[model samples]
Target: MRIYGPSGTTIGSPAGNTKRSGSTGFSLPDDAASTQATRPAAAPKAAANIDALLALQGIEEDPVERRKRSVQRGKGALDVLDDLKLGLLAGNFDASTVGRLREAAANLKASSGDPGLDAVLSEIELRVEVELAKAGQF
Candidate 1:
């Protein structure tokens, strides 16, 4: 009677020599881009939106990370301010634009450690809040 166990050259193995077969390469196409292009673009955009939403919540507050995020928020708020101001000048302060400005203000609450920049950010945030409130009353 023979008991079957590991056949490879491992500890307590019965045989020291093992026979292995050569692995054949898969018959995949060389042009990966062609295959990838067939996928629906909407799937990637939805995944990107989810990733962005996650990134926005509970962001790391390490000094370097905070500075990077703070700069992003400041720049984003400024861009929103520019757009909002331009739209206000053009008499286009619809609810959508007001909502976007409010969102920017909310995200721009972090201080960047610079007195001058902090003051400017505070002013921009205050203006956005005031503008949104005034728009809401109308």
Candidate 2:
């Protein structure tokens, strides 16, 4: 008869008691039993305290300063778009198309203020589509 493991993989044969074999490929030495006898017993789990958890809720502070610091930090959307334009022109496009895309992006930046970067990106995407269409890439 076959004995299967938890995942249904067959482990070994289960025949007569004298012929029964476990999964261990090698025989254990007689000294192995003595080595296991001296191991320390595992410690019991600690009980949870509801009062300690409730006390932690009162210690937490508000985050007004962190919000102000984040608002002041880092480049805004226009800076990122300018960088992307530079990368695109440097990678594949000719000078005339890159120039027109850059001019449209600048116009978009001036008109839309902070939110205009999205429009600028959209303009660049349109320019790429037009170029790709010219080359029959799309």
Candidate 3:
């Protein structure tokens, strides 16, 4: 994965099977040297400009607010899923209804993207749907 400079020297991660040499790597190519010489030295000025942009926008880091937002999103998803499960269980269950319920449960599991939770929810929903169908609830 490591890319190398033109001089056969490692510049980035070692190419397939190579390892990093602490802090420094092999030499640069002659072309690389010429390129470096011609390159404008504007890194410090760019960094100052970035800092000014941040200050002008009055941006500040807030880890607590970020965590709160994440928690709220998680709770909202959970609430929607809970409501779906409850509705599925309470609905009449004919063969066609059961099939639809199974499809919905599978879709829910797929969209949630968590295999463990998907499995548990799928089991609970499928068992209830099957029982209701057998009892002629539909």
The best candidate by TM-score is 1
The all-Cα superposition gives candidate 1 an RMSD in Å to the true structure of: 13.3
Which lDDT values do the candidates have, in the order given? 0.69, 0.46, 0.50
Clash pairs, model 1 backbone: none
Deviating ranges (above 4 Å) for candidate 2:
1-28, 31-114
**Per-residue lDDT of 45-91 in model 1, one digit per residue for the tens?**
34557777767664654556666777788788778778877877998
Lowest lDDT sum, 10 consecutive residues, model 2, at 68-77
**lDDT tens digits, residue span 1-138, model 2:** 344334554546443333325764634445555678666888987648877775675345234443332222222323444554676678864555445444543433322223344454456555544543553431
Answer with 1 or 3, whichever has the higher TM-score: 1
Question: What's the lDDT for residue 100 in model 2?
Answer: 48
For each candidate, what TM-score against the reference?
A: 0.48, 0.22, 0.26
Model 3 stretches with alpha carbons more than 4 Å out: 1-61, 92-138
**Cα lDDT tens digits for candidate 3, 1-138:** 434645665656535533446767664545555565565656554455776886655345354554444444444444544554666688833355445544543443322334554465556556645544554643
Clashes of each: 0, 0, 1
